[model samples]
Target: MKRYKKYITPYLSAFVIGPLMMLTEVAGEVMLPKFMSMIINNGVADRNLAYIGKMGALMVLTVLFMAVGGILGAYFSAKASISFTSDMRNDLFQKVQQFSFENIDGYSTGSLVTRLTNDVQQVQNVLMMGLRMALRAPGMFLGALIMAFMMNRQLAVIILIVIPLLLAAIILILKTAFPRFGEMQRRLDRLNSGIQESLTNVRVVKSFVREAHEIEKFSRLNRDLKESSLRALRIVITTMPVMMFAMNVTTLAVVWYGGNIIIAGKMPVGDLTAFTTYIVQILMSLMMLSMVFLQSSRASASMKRINEIFDTEIGLNDDNAKNKDKKVTEGRVEFKNVSFGYSGENGRKDLVLEGISFMAEPGQTIGIIGSTGSGKTSLVQLIPRLYDVTGGEVLVDGVNVKEYSLKHLREGVGMVLQKNVLFSGTIEENLRWGNEDAPMEDVIRFSESAQADPFVKTFKNGYGTEMGQGGVNVSGGQKQRLCIARALLKRPKILILDDSTSAVDTATEAKIRESLYHDLKDTTKIIIAQRISSVQEADQILVLEDGKIIGHGTHEELLKTCETYSEIYTTQIGNQSIGAGEEAAV
Candidate 1:
């Protein structure tokens, strides 16, 4: 409630005025029936044309006033709810942005999307409906009930019996509906996940001829969602008929009992007619109230889910940093007996890298070679504090990396990941992510160093050319080159390339290496690659196997001393010779 005050306080006027306006409609509703009754019982009974004409004019004026009130009520409610939702959505997005990698692992991309969009929509709908009817329905019920009893208490007694029955039915339906709504929302999460995964990888699905498999998978999820929705909605389906039945039965009781009074001359026909209208108003108000409660049940489920996100404990933050003001100035990196792992089921640690220790001085190029799943990427990720070490300390510039704020620590290191990702924007716009205020000359210079400028110039729009989502319009090697260019523009003290150039040819890779060694002579370079040639000239190289470092030396030292390194080098050379011979024969 305290958190929500920020969203509601700014719209306090609309929140108050909306329901107050609805009260005006309630006042007119109660008075109009009496006005109609007067025209019938007084003017028509006495055959007075002037009395009937005056009452008719009053009824017309009351309806016009009610119409104006209803319109204002609706407009204000919508304004308040829409504004509240807009502000809440923005806050929720900011909260998600603050989530650490571990926190994000607790949620899926699609589930977060659902929470930000669908869940907030549910809260908005309830707010809008509640604002309009929260006061109006109860006001109508009380006012109409008072008038009914004043006109004839005998007829109002029948309403008491019908009210309890309707109340019981509504309570039972709501109790059964709440859990079903929760289940339906879970199914919606699964369906959204399926859709997002399929669409994001639609090209891969087609390339592998798995489109049919994906379609069937989607159909299964869709069917499950439909079934869950129907289960939840079946309670609503049962509610409407039950309420209508109770309304009809109550109205019949009023008309039947009141008819006897009118015939016996104990009540006027006009009074009986007015009494029946009040009975309908009372029951209809109950129906409106029931609908509000039903919507509230679903909103409660949504709010519970949203609170989960807000309640999540962010495990990684600089809140306890001993040196929060410290920044990474010199990019000298060292790992001191660092052992890292991810948490698994039952609170167990699944160790990925064990007892790893290394160092790279500023202006040195360190090469890391490993088999698949040997934790090459994991090692470099620690430099940026993307994931913290579980055992020992990682230091940058002789200070613990955890002591630096994440923003400053990451800004000093530039990383190009194995998977290249480009957003939907122009090429120049993408490069600006590295340095938003970079001039055109710097952009072109970095592009040339990355071996991307020649190909980019061939495009009709050059740097202005649009790259489709995820760079789908470009080839794999081009995407990799552009990613390198973006990272190069940052001019960081430490640059880590995690197999970022696997898609490019060996000659182009050599050129890129030469550019880095020549131009960024002072930067610390860490290259993780599979081919030995890629790192043959590196100042030092480390070989990893099964989460442990088995060898460490310069390229020649490793080749002569490390048996594993020697075999890898010999195998790659032999394969290159065989490929050259096959090409000559062709």
Candidate 2:
């Protein structure tokens, strides 16, 4: 509540005005019955036409005021709630953008999406209802109860007994429903995760003919979500029937007790009639109160989830950071006995990269090759401070990476990741992500260097062609080229290609490397590839096994000095030689 004070601060006027306007409705409603009683007992009984007419006009005016109050209350509620959610959603998005990869890994993408969209809506809805009903319901309840007691005290005892019973029931239902609502939200996250995973891997699913399996898996999650939703709402739904029963019982007691009182000459006929109206008002207010409680149960769960994100102290902020305003101009990069792992547990966790020592001089081309799960990707991820080194230090331009601001460090490194992504937009729009101000000539120059220009021009729209979501419209090889071109457009001091060209042919990969060497002569380039041919021409090559660096040298130097490097090169060339002989025979 304290942390969320900022959101309420901007809308304080609306928040105040909405409930105060609703009070006008409450006052009108609570007074109308008393006016009717006066009209009936005095005017109708004594045949006083003047009094009847005067009181009747007052009642009409009150009803009109109530109508105006309701509309105004609704207006303020709308304005306040819409504005609140807008600010909340924007802040949530900015928070996510600032999250380090480590922070992102702490939450699933689907869970975060649910919190941002569905959970926020739950809170928004409750806020709107609270603005309109929070004050009005309680005001009406107390006012009507007081008026009922004034008309006939004995009959009011029924309300005293029944109201407490209903309150107890609401408390009980809410206690059970709160935990159930949290479970239901978790189930919704699971369902969303399933849907996202299935759609993103649709191509693989189709290739394997696994549509039926996917459908079955989805159906199971959907059914779990349905059951969880029903369980939580069943508690909420039960409140309505229990409240209606209490209302009806209270109404019957009022009518029965007041009828006897009037018969005994202890209460007037008109007063008995007014007492019934007050009884109805009291019960209705309780119903509104029960609805408020029910909504609060669900929204309370959402609030906790929302506050969790706000409370998550960003572990990668620039506070207490050295070289906070400094820049990294040179491309030189070094790792000194660097070790990292994904976990942050108290005990020692498995290290993904251990005791790794490496250095790349400015303008050097470094190749990293190893078997799968050999920490090649993880090693480069440390360069951009995506994840901090667990044991030692990573340095760029002779400064510890932790010293430089994240923006400066990342700006100096252009990366085409192992899993590349292009957002939904035109080809030009995606390329401009590296350098938004890049001109047409720069775009063409990089595109040609990436071996992407020829294919791009073949399309009707050329650079303006629309790429569907995640670059779905392009072939794998074409996407690789476009990604390479985008990175080239950045003109970064350090460029990392993490197996980004595996989809292209060996000849095309060779051409890309040639253009990179010629065009980006001063850029420190790191290529992580599985193919020995892809790395053979590099100035330096590293052979990794497990999480350790096992070999390091140039192509000819490694082939003679490192057995692991020699075995890999011999195997790749032997296979290629066999293929060449077979092709010549054919």
Candidate 3:
């Protein structure tokens, strides 16, 4: 919370003024009862019209002040709290953006969304409530208690008895309420996760006719959230009844004792009236404070969740890089005995890629062919430093990948991932993500090279056409080409395509490969493909199996020496004997 001082400092005036204005409202509220008592005991009884009119005018003036103060308090509180949370949310988002793939794996996407939206909102709401009442509640209680004692000390003693009882109840309720609120937030996370998953893959769900299953899952999550919310709220709501009961008992005690005193002509009726009002005020302030506490309990849970984001140490950063100023110049990528695995609990690494070693010189196309889960994607991912190698060093241009700053390193390499993703925007805008300042000429040129230009122009808006979220508006082949076009716009020193052209037809795929080789001769290219034909013309081919490269050579060389490569080639294109003509001549 102390770390939040910077956010508050910017809105310091609002923070200060909000509470002060609330105290002014409290000042008027505490005095209103006294004014009413004066009008009842003095003005009415004395039969003086002038005094009554004057007192009535003062009461009106006091109410006017209270009205002004309350309005100012609410406005400033909202201004300050909203501004505070806005800054906090931005910082939280920035921190999330800094997270490497490994760090992100620690949190669910739904959990992060909840932390940014729901959790930040909870803290903002509580901050607003607290600003309005944090000081006012105590101010009213103290002011009312002082007035009650001044009116009659004996009656005030009854308040002291009920105060402890109310305090005990509030404490007990809060104890149970905090943990329940935490559980409620966790349930909310689950609901959000379920919703996100179902909606994001809604096409799959519909294709498989799993709508009923998804609905059932959502209903269960909804029910769980509802139940948890009720549990948290039920405990907090109990406080209101307990406070009211205490207030009633205390009021009755005051009236009984004060009535006896009045019968003996010991206290004036005006004073008794004021004393009773003060007693209510005191108890009401305590209730207000208790409600603040209850809100804070819920907000505390949210703040804890938010702080988890802030507290997360980003596993990937260039802070300690020796060559932070260095850029990837040549795109000469080399993996030297690299072994990588996702770290599990207690820092255990189950290797996905074992003893991976290769080198791709600038202007060379390296083809990585492997079965599913054979770490083809894993090897290339290390190039962009998406995940650091767990065992050995990955080098680019003779410098260790870790030595280069992430911004410069990633800027030099372009990757079109296995799953092609496009955002909700115009087609041109999505393409511009590769290079924001790229000219329209460059955009069209690259699109042509990726074989996307023709189909893109077929759309009514062409490049200006609005794309659905994740490019749902386009066909799979169109999406793949668009992704490839986007990557080419980067004009990076190194380009990695992880089965990016899988959806395109063989002719179109061949055209794309031809374009890559022709257009990006200076840029190092690494292609991971399922189809053997896709990488048959590559400068070098690495055949992988069971997390190891079992064969490495040119296509013809592999056919002669490598069994795995031959099997893949035979399975894909049929065994066309390269020596059949020579055998026929013999």
In order, the Cα lDDT scores of the candidates are: 0.91, 0.91, 0.93
lDDT of 2 by residue, 1-586 (tens): 7767788999999989999999999999999999989988999989999999999999999999999999999999989998898899999999989988878877888889999999999999999999989899999999999999888778988889888888899899889999999999899989988998999999999999999999999999999999999999999789889988888888888888788888888887888888889888988898898888888899999888888887787857776559988876889999999998876666456788999998999999999999999999999999988888899999999999888888888888999999989999999999999899999999999999999999999999999999999999999999999999999999999999999999999999999999999999999999999899898888889999999999998999998998998999899999999999999999
lDDT digits (tens) for residues 1-586 of candidate 3: 5899999999999999999999989999889888888887889889878989999999999999999999999999999999999999999999999999999999999999999999999999999999999889999999999988888998888988888888888999999999999999999999999999999999999999999999999999999999999999998778888888888888888999999999999998988899999988998999989989999999999999998999998999997689988888898999899999988999898999999888899999999998899999989999999999998889999999899999999999999999999999999999999999999999999999999999999999999999999999999999999999999999999999999999999899999999999999999999999998899899899998988999998999999999988988887654335455567889
Q: Which ten residues in a row have the lowest lDDT in candidate 3?
A: 573-582
After superposing all C-alphas onto the true structure, candidate 2 shows an RMSD in angstroms of: 1.4
Stretches > 4 Å off in candidate 2: 47-50, 344-348
lDDT of 1 by residue, 342-381 (tens): 7778868888999999889999999999899998998888
lDDT-wise, the better of 1 and 3 is 3
Q: How well does each candidate superpose onto the true structure, as a TM-score?
A: 0.98, 0.98, 0.97
Model 1, stretches more than 4 Å misplaced? none
Candidate 3 wrong stretches, greater than 4 Å: 575-586
**Highest lDDT, which number?**
3
